[model samples]
Target: MNSGDLPPSRPLLVVDDDRKLCGLIRDYLAPRGWQVDMRHTGPEGLEAASTGDYEAVLLDVMMPGMDGFEVLRELRKTSTIPVLMLTAMGEEADRIVGLELGADDYLPKTFSSRELLARLRAVTRRSVRSGEAADAGKEWSAGDLTLNEETHLVTLDGGNLELTALEFAILASLLKAKGRVKSREALLEEVSDRRFDVFDRSIDVHVSQLRRKLGDDPKQPRFIHTIRGVGYKLKEPA
Candidate 1:
C-alpha cells in the first residue's frame, strides 16, 4: 500500500527488558498504524514515556532496576498517557495491580498480534474519549462531588480525591449524563472501541473504586446509584 493510503501512524512506546521482544514488537506494529519505540529498562521507559510524545505505552510487568508497577505509579503523577500493561500469562494479581496503579488496560505477555493491536487501540481510544470529555465542559457537579473536566480534578465535599484515569472517565461520564441512566454497554462503548463481552466487569470495578473515593455506599448511595440491570446514574445536584 502507498504511504498516502495507509492510516496515520501513532507513536507507541514498548517498555520491556527483553531486547528481542522489543524488536519483534517494533517490527510488528510499525506498519500497522503504530510507530513503535522500544525501551529496555524501567527507568528508561519512565523517562521516555514522561516526555508526552507517545500516544500510548505497552509496559511489561517484569523489568530491571524498576518494575512496571513502580513506573506506572510514578508516571501517573504527571502524565495521563494511555498505558497497556503486559503481564505474565495468568497473573491475575499483576493485572489487578497494574490497573490499581493507573494502567488503562492489560494484556498477557504471550499475546497474539491481533490481541496486542486490539488492546493498544482500545487504551488509546479510551484516552481520546477522556480528553474529548475534558474539552466538552469545564466542570460537572452533583451534590458535594465535583469534577473539573478541564483540569482533570475530582473533589468531594471540597476535599480533593485521587482517582485513576478510568475512575475519572467513569465519574465524568456519569456526571455528563446526570440523573439519566447510563447503560453498561453505552459506557463501555464510550471508554473503548473493543467488542462487548458482557462478562467483563472492569467497568464495575472502576465505579466501585470511584465510589469508595467519594465515600459513597452502594446501598443508599450518595453520589452514584446502581440502576440494577441497566447500569448507573449520577445523583443530581441538590
Candidate 2:
C-alpha cells in the first residue's frame, strides 16, 4: 500500500505472549478500521516489526525470552517505528525505563482495550506528526536552545540533544511558553498531541530525561526550573 494509504487506518502489530489477549485485540481493533497482527513471542514480534509493513507496534513488557524492553532497544538501533509498550508492572520506574529506552507510551496490563485504542490512536498520530511541520512557528530558539518543529529536532548549548519526539515536543512546548509555569497536564496536552488526563507522570519522565540530556541539574538547573508544587518553566538565559 502507498504510504498515504497506510496510517490512521492501517495495520497495527500487537505483540504479547498471551495468545488470548492478542486474539481479543485483533478482533476488537479490526472493526475499528485497523488491520491487526498478533504474535505470542518477543523475538517473533521483533522480527515481524522489523520486516513487516505495520504502521505501529504494540509490545508487551514481559515475554518468556526477549522481553519488550530488549525488543524495543534492539528496534531502536535501526527503526524509528512508533512503539507503545504494555506492562504488568505498573511501577513508575518501569514506565520511565520504557520511555528512556525510546518507547512512546506504556499501558498497564489491566488497562481497558478502549483505553488501548485511544492510546494507539494517539501514538500513531504522534508518529505521523513527526513527518510534518508545526504551524506558523516551525522553529523556536532561546539562548542556546533551538528547536525545529518541522524536523522534530532540538539542540542545546551548541550540542545536538538526541531527543525522542516527545522529548523534543516537551522542550519545544516549554520554550514556546517560556517564562510560564506549565502544569504537567498542560505540557502533556501540548506535547503529546492529545488530551491530558490523570496519569501525567509521563511528562515528568520526559522532562527529567530532557534535563539529563541538557545537563540541567534539578538542584541547580540552568534551563528547566521546577515550581514547588505546580509545574515547570523554561529559564531563558540572559
Candidate 3:
C-alpha cells in the first residue's frame, strides 16, 4: 500500500536484534491493518520511538549493546507509549522485570502468530484511542480524581499524577462509567478491542498496578474499587 493509503493511525514498531525474526513479524502483521516498522537494535528502536509517531512498540528482550530493559528504562524517561516486550520461553524473571520497568505487556518467544496479532491489535487500539479527542473538554470526575478529556490529563487530589498509556486508559474507562460495576471482561474490552479469556489476567495486573500508582488501597479504594467476581468501579471521591 502507498503511504497515503497506509493506516497511519495503526502504525506499530517491532524492535528486535534478530533480523530474520523482525522481518517475519513485520511481514506477518502488516496485512492485519497495521503499518509495521522494523528496527534491528535497541538504540535504533529508541530513536524511532522518540519520534512519537508509532502507536505502540513490540520490543524484544535480548539485544546487544542496549538490552530491552535498558531501552525500556530510557523510553520511560521521556515517553509513555504502549510497549509490549518479547521474552524467551521460561524467562519469567525477565517478563516480571519488563513489567516492573513499565512495559504494558509481555509475549514470550514461541508465541502464536494469531495471539501476537491479537495483542498488536489490542495494544494499537488502546494507544490510538487514548489521545483521541472525543467529546472534547468534557469533564469527568471520580472522587478526588478529575480528568479533562480535551487535555487528556488527570489530577488526584489536586496533584498531577504521572500515568502511562494503559494506566490512563484504565482510569479513564472506570471514571467514564462511575457507579456501575464493570466486569473484567468489559474492562478488557474497554482497554483493548478483544474479548476476555479466563487465562487472561493481564487486565487485573494492570488495574492493580494502576491502583498502586494512584496510591489507592484495594481494601478501601478511594478511586477504583474492585467488585469481587465481577470487575471494578471508580468511586467518586467525597
Candidate 4:
C-alpha cells in the first residue's frame, strides 16, 4: 500500500498479543490505503512505538511483560504518538483507565471493520490536522501557557510542554475562546474530526490531563476553570 494516499503521515502500528487479530487488522487496513506494522508483545510494541514513525498505534490492554498501560505510560513520558487502545467489550473502567494513561481513543475488541476504519481515520486525521500549517505564525496565550501554532510548540512558564494531539487541540480551543465557557459539545466539535456525543467524557479526561501538565489545581484554579455544569474556561491570571 502506498502510504502517501493515506491520511496518516506514516504507516499504522498495531500491537496485540493476538496474532490473528493483528493479521486481520493489517488485512483490513492495507486494502483501504493504510500500511500497517504489527508488534505482538508489550515490550516489542513499546520499542516499535517509541522508535517508529507510525501515524498511530492500535494497542491491546492485555499483553505480556509490560501490558498496554505500562507501555502507554512509558510512551507518554517522551512521545505523544496517537494511541488507540483495544479493550474488552463493556469495560468502562478499562476505557477510562486507558484514557487516563493518555490513550487517544478506545475500541472494543468486537468492533466492526467500518467502526475500526472510522476510528483509525479519526485519530490519524487529528495528528495530520495538528501538524498542519494553517495556523502558521499565530499564537495564543493565557497566563503562563503559550502555544505557537507555527512551531506546534507549547510552553508554560518558559518551559516546553509536550502535549498529545487531542490535548493540544483542546487547549487551543480553550485558549482561542478565552474567558468564555466552552461547553463540551462546542469543544468536541472544534477539536475532533469525528462525531462525538456531547456527553462523552473523553473530552473531560483530556482536559484533566492538560490541566495536570499545566500545573493548575482544579480547586483554587490557576488557569483552566470548570464552569459548574456548563464546561470550562481559561482565566488570564491576575
Model 4 misplaced stretches (Cα beyond 4 Å): 1-9, 194-199
Report clashes for each candidate as comma-separated counts. 0, 0, 2, 0
Per-residue alpha-carbon lDDT of candidate 1 for residues 1-238, written as tens digits (9 for 90 to 100): 4553226678999999999999989888877777888888899999999984999899999987899999999998988788899999888788777876677788888899878877776677666655565475688888778888767778887888877666778888899899899998888777755555676666776677777778888987887999999899998644
Model 1 lDDT-worst window of ten = 1-10
lDDT of each: 0.81, 0.80, 0.81, 0.86
Judged by TM-score relative to the true structure, which candidate is superior, 2 or 4?
4
TM value for model 2: 0.84
lDDT value, residue 214 of candidate 3: 85
Off by over 4 Å in 1: 1-9, 133-139, 147-165, 196-199, 212-220, 227-230
Writing each residue's lDDT as its tens digit, candidate 3 over 1-238 gives 5443335347788899888998888777676567788898989999999885888899999999999999999998888888999999988778778877888878999999888877766676666566777777788887677877677778877998777777888888888888988899988887766678886777777888788878989988788888888899887765
Against the true structure, whose TM-score is highest? 4
Q: Which of candidates 1 and 3 is the stronger one according to TM-score?
A: 3
Candidate 3 lDDT (Cα, 0 to 1): 0.81
> How displaced is residue 64 in candidate 2, in Å?
0.8
Clashing residue pairs in candidate 4 (N, C-alpha, C atoms within 3 angstroms): none
lDDT of predicted model 2: 0.80
Clashes of 2: 0
Which scores higher on lDDT, 3 or 4?
A: 4
How many residue-pair clashes does candidate 1 contain?
0
Candidate 2 versus truth, CA RMSD in Å, comes to 3.8
